[model samples]
Target chain A: MASMANQGAPERRPGIPGTPGGQPRGRGLSMRTRQLFWVWGFLALPVLFYGVIRFYPTLNAFWLSLTDWDLMSEPEFIGIDNYTRMFSDPEFWKVFRNTFTYLIVGTPISLVLSFLIAFALDRIRFGHTFLRALYFLPYITTASAMAWVWRWFYQPAPIGFINDLLGRVGIPQMAFLNSTTWALPSIMVTAIWAGLGFQIIIFMAGLRAIPTTYYEAARIDGLGEASILRRITLPLLKPTTVFLVVFSSIGFLRIFDQVYNMTTNDPGGPLGSTKPLVLMIYQTAFSSYEMGYAAAQTVVLFTILLCVSLLQLWLLRER
Target chain B: MRTQILMAGLLAGTSLVAGTAAQAVEIEYWQYVYETRVTAMDQLIDAFEAANPDITVKQVTFPYADYQTRVVAANMARKGPDVLQMFYGWTDQFVGGKVIQPLSPEVFPHDEIEAEFFPIVTAMKRGDDYYGLPTAVRSLALFYNKDLMTKAGLDPENPPKTLDEMVAAAKAMTEMDAGGNLSTAGMTLDMGGQDHQWWREVLVRQFGGEPYSADYSQVTYNDAAGAAALKFYTDLQLVEKVGQRGFMDEGQAAFRAGRAGLTIDGTFRLGSFSSIEDFEWGVTELPANAEGVRSNYASYFANGIGIGAEGEELAAAEKFLAYISSPEAMKIWLDVVGELPARRDVALTEENLADPIYAPFLKGLDYAKTTLFIDEAAQRQNAIDMANRILIDGQSVEESLAQAAEAEQAIIDKAK
Candidate 1:
C-alpha cells in the first residue's frame, strides 16, 4: 500500500508519510525512538532553561574565578591570584569553618527531630491530618520572615519570650544572638525548625509504605515497642532518612537568608561568628563588587557541597 | 474640502505635541526607600516640576539594603538614573570609580557651597570638585527617657556634661534583679550592631586620635588613644554593668519602652520617637570627654548625577539638585522626615536653634564627621570584629585595636 501511494506521486522524493525530513517510510515506530520522543519532548524545555540560566553562568563562574572583575569594568584575567589570596585570607578560613559547622551540626539534629515527630504523627488517628498540616506550616513560610520571628524569640527578658519564660522559672538570662558561641546554634535551631515540616511529611509517607502485617506479626511474636522500632521501623526508614540527610545537608551547607536577615545590623556579625560561606560570597559579590573573588569563594562552596553530599550518601548506604 | 480640514487638524496636533516635547526635559531621581523619604521626595519632585514647567523629574526608590547594589547594576547596564542619592561614606567609591560627575562649577561655585552649607561640606569636597550636595544632614545625639531618669532619681533636665558624670548617671539609672540580671539598662552600648560607627567617628577623636587620615591613606586608631577610647566605651558594660549584651533590641526599643536611661542615635530617630506618647523623652548632646572635648557623628545622604548623561538630561538633573538643596525643599524635608537642614542658614535660625528636640543635634554639627572609606561596610565590619574580640573573648582592647588597623588598612589599599 505504501509503494502504491509513492507511485501515485512519483515526482515526490521518498520520505516518511508525516515527518518533514525526507527518508524511506516505515510501517511502525520503534520502541526506543518512540520512548525517546516522549522523553526528549518533555526534557527540551527544562534543558533549554538550565542551559541558558543555570549551566552557562556556572561555567562562566569557573572562568571568572581566574580573573579580576569588579562588575563595573571588563573582567581582567589574572591566573590563580584570586585563589591564592583567598587561601591566605583569615576571613575566608573563618567563613569556611562556619559553613561546615552548619552542615555537621544542623543535618543530624534536623533529621532526628523530623523523624521523631513523623514517627509519633503516623500512629495518631484523632486529628492526624490537622497535626500533620500544623507540622508542615513552617516549610511554607518565607525564610526571612521566619528568621525575624526567631530573632524576637531569642531576645532578653521584657522583650524576648524565651528569656521571659526563663526568668519566670528562676533561670538566669542566657545570651542567644549576642554571644559568639551561642549565635550559630540559636540560628541552627530556627533553620532546623523551619525545615522540619517538609521532612516530617516525607518521613510519614515512608512510614506509611511499611506493611501493617509486619508490625502485627512482630506484636504476636511478643516483641516490645522499642524493639519493633529498632528492628523493623528504622530498617525500613533507611531510604527516607538517606534522602533527607543529603537534601538537608545541602540546605544547611548553603544557608544564607537566615543568617543574613538575623544579623542585619552587622551581617555575619558578633565578630563574623555566624558568617557562612554563602553570606561571605554575597558580601564579596554585592557589597564589595569583587566579582572575581566572589566566584572563587562560590567555587569552594560548590566543591564542599558536592563532596559533603557524596560522603553522606556513601556513608548512609546499606552495607 | 473635507480632506483639507482633516490634514489641517492632524498638523495642528503634531506641532502641539512637538512643542511640548521641545520645551520639557525629564530626569530620573533614585533613592533608597524609607516611607518618609519616599513621601518627602515625591512632594519635592512635584514642587520642583511645578516651579520649573520646562523640566520633569521622575522618582525611583529601592529598599535600603539593596539600593547601592541596584544602582551599580543599573549603571552597569547603562540604565542608571540621572540623579542618585547615596550615603556620605559611599562618596569615596563613587569618586574613585568616577561613577558620578562633579557638580557644575558655573552653577555651584566652591565658595557658594562652603558658605551655604556647614563645615561638614568641606570633607565632602574632593580637591576643588564638589561631588554631591545633601538636602539634610543627620548627627548623633543623646536621647533619654525622662520617666526612667526620674525613677533613677536623676534630673532629666540636666544631662551628663562630662565622661565621669555620664558613667555615674548610667550606674544610677540601671536596675538589677537579686540574681544580678539587668531589669532596666542604664544605656545600651552600641554593642555589635553599629558600635563601630560610634567608635571611629566620635570616640576616637575625643580620645585625641584621628580614625583615618583626611587623604584616606592610613588608619591611626590602633594607637594608645584608640585603646583608651575602646576601654572607656566597653567599661560601661564590663566594669559598671550598666547594660549588658544579652538584651534584645536594646538600642531603639529599650529607650522607647522606658527600660533604658539613655541612647545615642541619629537625628533621623526623631520620626520613630515622635510616635511614643506614654513616656516623655528629651534629646541632648552626647557627654563630652573627661577633657571636655566634644565630637559627634554627622552622616548624610547626598544626591549626585550619574555618568553617561549629557546635554538636556544632565542639565535637567542639575536643576532638580538645585531645587532639592534650596531652603524650601530642605525645610520641607526636615519637617516631614527628621534630619537637620544641611544649609547652615536654614538650620541656625532662632526658631530651629531654640527647638529643644532638634537643637542638640544641630549643636553637634560643628565638630561632627563622617567616616570616609571606599567600602565603609568592610571597614565597619573590622570595627565590629574588634569590638567583639574585647566583649566576647575578654581579649585586651589594645591588641584588638592593633589588629583592626592592619585589617582596615588592607581594605583601603584594595579599594585604591
Candidate 2:
C-alpha cells in the first residue's frame, strides 16, 4: 500500500518546516512497508480461516441456493427452483411464523426482564456480586443441559416442578410443551431464561455507564422515580438499548439450541408449532440431506436477519 | 557377552514390532452411542483383532440424534468411517447419494445374505446389491404393567387379545384424581414415536390395507381402512379417554414407570426395562382390531462400509463385517445388547428361540412391516402432525388422515 501511494505520486511534504532529518521518505516508506508486512502476516491465518470456513461457505450458500445438489452429486444450477420450492412449501411458512414468534415476543420480554433484574441488582449493595454471579450462571452453562433442566421443569405434576407448583396452588394442569398453543411460548420462556444472564450483565454495564450525578440532580429537582428514569436514565441508556435490541433480536431469529434440546424427543413438535426456521434448515440439510433447499432457506433467514436488525436499530436509534 | 546377546534380541523384537505396525491396516467402525453397543463393539473388535493380527478396528461413536449428521459430514470430507451402522430406512438415501458402498457379490454375496439373515432383514436389498448387514434385529410388542392391570381389577394373566378388549381393559384401568385429571393412564399414545407405527403398521393392517405400495412409489394408507385405523387410535384418546399423553412425558416411559397399563413399544425396551425392579411387567402380542388380524413394525441397524475407502481399509472393513455376521459375534451381540440375531441360522437356533424374552419379538418378526422410505424424516413429521391434528386440533379422522396421506405422497413423489 505504501508503494502504491508512492507509485501514484511522490509526496513532497514540508518536512516539519525547520526539521533537518525528519525521517527521510525512503526510510519511512520501507519502515511502513515492514509494519504492513508483519501486520498482514499476523492477520493471514485468520483471513484464510474465515475465507475457507466462514466466508467461502457463506458465499457458496448464495450460489448453492440456486442449485439442486444433495451434497452427494454435482450441483446443477436450477435458477431459483430452490427458492420457489421454499416459498411454496407450507412447512416453510409455518417455520417462518414460528421464527417470528420467537423474535417478536422473545426479544422484548427478555430485554425487559433482564433490564429490570439488572436495575434492581444495581441498587442492591449487599450480596450484589453474589446475586449477579448467580444470575449470570445460566449464561455459562451449556445450552443443551439448561434446556433439559427446563424441560424437566415443564413436565406434568408429580414430576415437573412448575406443574407441581400450579397443582398445589389449585390451578388446572397446563400442557407446557405438549399443546400446540403452549409449546412455542414454552420454548420461548426457556430461550429467554438461557439468554437472560448475558443480557443482564450487558444491561448492568449500560446502567453503570450512566453518571450518578444525573440521578442526584433529578432528586434535587423533586423528580419522582418514574420521572427520573424516563427523563434522565432511559435517554442516556439509548445506545445500550439499541445494541441489546439488535443483539437479542438476532439471537431469537437464529434460535435452534433451545428448541432442539427442549423438545429432544420430537424437536419442534406438537404439529410444528415450535418449529423455527433454523431447526427447519437443520432438518433439510442433515435429516433430509437436501443441501440446495437448506441453502435456500438460509438465504431467506439471512435476508430476514438483515431486515430485522436494521429495523430494530432504526426503531431504537436516538433522535 | 550375555548382556550384548540380550540387547541384540531386544533390537530384533523392536524390528518385528515395527514390521507389524507398518503392515497393520486400521479401519474405523462408527456406531451410535449406547453402553451395551459400545461394550458389544469392543468385544467384537477385540475378537476380530485377536483372530487377524494384521488388521485393526478403531471403534468410534456419536450420539444417536447426531449420528447421521456426523456421518454425512465426515463422508462429505472423504474421511467417513471405513464401516458404519446405518438404520434400515437410511440405506436407500445413503446408497442413492453414493455416500456408502453397495456390497459387491465378492464382498457380500446375495444368496449368502439371504441364506444367513432372516428373510425380513433382506429388506436392506436395493436392486441387485446389498448396502449393509445387520447383526441384530428388533421388533415391536405390547409392554404391559401387570401391577396396573391387577389394581384396575383386570386379570393380570390375560392381557388384551382384541382391539375392543384392549379398549375395555384400558378404560377400566384408567385412574383419575379428585381433580378429574387422569392420575394413571391406561395407555400412552405419543404422536412423536409409536403413533406412526400404530397407524401405519398395526391398525392399518388390521383394517386390511398396506401403508405403502409395493414399489414404495405411493401412499396407500388413505382409504377407508386408513381412516378407520386412525379413528381407532384417536377414539382411544378422544372418545374413550382411556389414555392421556400428559400423564407421562415420553411415549414408552409411562409403561416403564408402571403408570401405563399398556404401551406398544419395540423390543429395544428390554435393555431399558431391566432396571425397573419397582414394576412387574411383561411383553405380549399386540391386540388385533375388529377384523382379527395382527401386524407389527420392525426396524434394524445394519453396519456397512462407506465410500472413499480403498486399499487395505476396505479389506479390513469387509473382514470386520464378515466376523460381525458370524454366529459367535451374533451370540455376543445378543448376550450383551439383548437384541435378536439378524441371521436366520443364529436367530432360529433352538436355544435362542426358546429364550423367554426373545420369543415375543421373534413371533412379531413373522408379521412385521419393514418400510424403506427415502424421505422417512418427512414421513415421520407428517405422522406426528396427523396425531396432533386428530388428538389436539380436534380435526376429524378422515380430514387429518387424508391430509397426512397427501403430504406423505408429496414427500414420496419428491424423493428420487
Q: Tell me the whole-model lDDT of each prediction, alpha carbons only.
A: 0.85, 0.84
Which candidate achieves the best TM-score against the true structure?
A: 1
Q: Write the per-residue lDDT of candidate 2 for residues B124-175, one digit (tens) a residue.
A: 7888778888989988887788888888898888889888998898888888
Predicted model with the maximum lDDT: 1
Across residues B1-416, which tens digit of lDDT does each residue of candidate 1 receive? 99999999999999999999998898889999999999999999989988889998889899988988888888778898899898878887677655788898998888899888987876568878898999999888888888888888999898888778878888999988765678789987765444567778778888998888877688878888888889988788889888866454647877778788888888888888899998988989877987889988788889888986689998888888898989999999988897889999999999998999989989988788766767877877787778778888889988888888998998888876
True contacts kept of each: 0.59, 0.49
Q: Write the per-residue lDDT of candidate 1 for residues A137-214, one digit (tens) a residue.
A: 999999999999999998877678898888888898878888889999999999999999999999999999999999
For candidate 2, give the lDDT of residue A190: 87
Quality class of the docking in candidate 2, CAPRI style: acceptable
Show pairs that collide, candidate 2. none
Per-candidate TM equals 0.91, 0.90
Please give, for residues A51-138, the per-residue lDDT of candidate 2 as tens digits. 9999999999999999998877778999999988888988899999999999989999999999899999999999999999999999
**Alpha-carbon shift of residue B19 in model 1 (angstroms):** 4.2
